[model samples]
Target: PGGVGRQLLQKPTPAPAQHPPVRYPLTGEPRILFWAQNFSVVQGSKWVDLTSQTFGAEASVDVSGSSWSSNDSRLVLKYANVLGSPLTATFHMTSRWFPVSGRDWFQLNRLELATPSARPTVFNASQVTAPSNYSWHCAHLSSLPGFGAGLRGHGPSPSWGVLLQDVQVPAGTPGFSPGSGRGSGREGLGGVLAGACLDEPFPPP
Candidate 1:
């Protein structure tokens, strides 16, 4: 009886190894070094400015508005000659959107970092927190009672409130561009970062 049972249940073959999807060209878990929610954080209508001065001493920003609703809630910030030193870093800002009443609105999400280094770093919104160095100043737009023609009170226009940078920050192609073919297994972020951000309805309401 024991021999007959063993013959009926043969040993199974081993399955091949499976790899998880890559999130950028880095190792370890993804983190959210910085983040900002919908334009709801900004009150003013005529203009809205969201500042990100929390990265480090070398990082400072002087902006008067944001690209929250326009340009898919994306922005590119480049710090040149970094204060007293001669270093630079580009912050590729992207967002996570959610559905609301058949429309989508921007949610504070991931940030992609690209330096002169060989690889790029990604900051997931769920992992990191606002650094101690972070500083922000949000104010509602004051009404200019009699500024423009037929102007009842100062407020943001339908499509003029949000402003995003029109620059492109591709994840980069592997083994093609400058300093591409490096890192673990020669894997490049070009395939990951260039188009990793999923597409959703734009001009989030």
Candidate 2:
């Protein structure tokens, strides 16, 4: 009986090894970074002035140590609150087991938009923050907001993300105090009068 059982089971074949994909000529990860805007809860329709000093604020997420990859066909990147953190998401991929470096065609963006809302994982704060007072002052900002993937370049060619990496925050930018946009004393704050009381280490919100 033991001999007959051995014959019933056959050896299985192994899968082929996958290799790293080559980037498009002059094309690669978007390499773009974005900072979400946070602001105070003021009454009435208050136009968030980008010119004057914003009392306290920051971009959506820290853009330092950030990069992108188009190779993530089925990848679910999370918008992390911390710099250099992986973009995490409840990826609704058809499968998880992929050959290493295999081009898995998964819809990561669709998975994110499929849900009602996206929850904050790291940079969760009770108060609000704002973007930079000056439009061009941001580390990776050009002129407008990005689309699904990121900032599209000019013409039919279309541009991807082109923000600077490893950007550091100054006293007046945003997301300094409270680690969630409460530092009012920083310099370029656009008209958001956070005058005086800057000697303290942390913010006073």
The top-ranked prediction according to TM-score is 1
Give the CA lDDT, 0 to 100, for residue 56 in model 2: 21
Q: Per-residue CA lDDT of candidate 1, range 98-188, in tens? A: 3443332233344433346324344333221111112111111111323211112122232122222111122211111211212322133
Tens digit of per-residue lDDT, candidate 2, span 1-205 = 9988887886767532222211111133322212213211111233222211211233232223222343332222223421222333221222122466453322212222111232322211111112222111122222124311222333332111222211112212221332112334224342332221111222332
TM-score of each: 0.24, 0.18
Model 2: residues >4 Å from true position, as ranges? 1-34, 38-188, 192-205
- How many residue pairs collide in each prediction? 12, 25
Predicted candidate 2, C-alpha RMSD? 24.6
TM-score of the candidate numbered 2? 0.18
Local lDDT at 165 for model 2: 16
Q: Give the lDDT of residue 195 in candidate 1.
A: 17
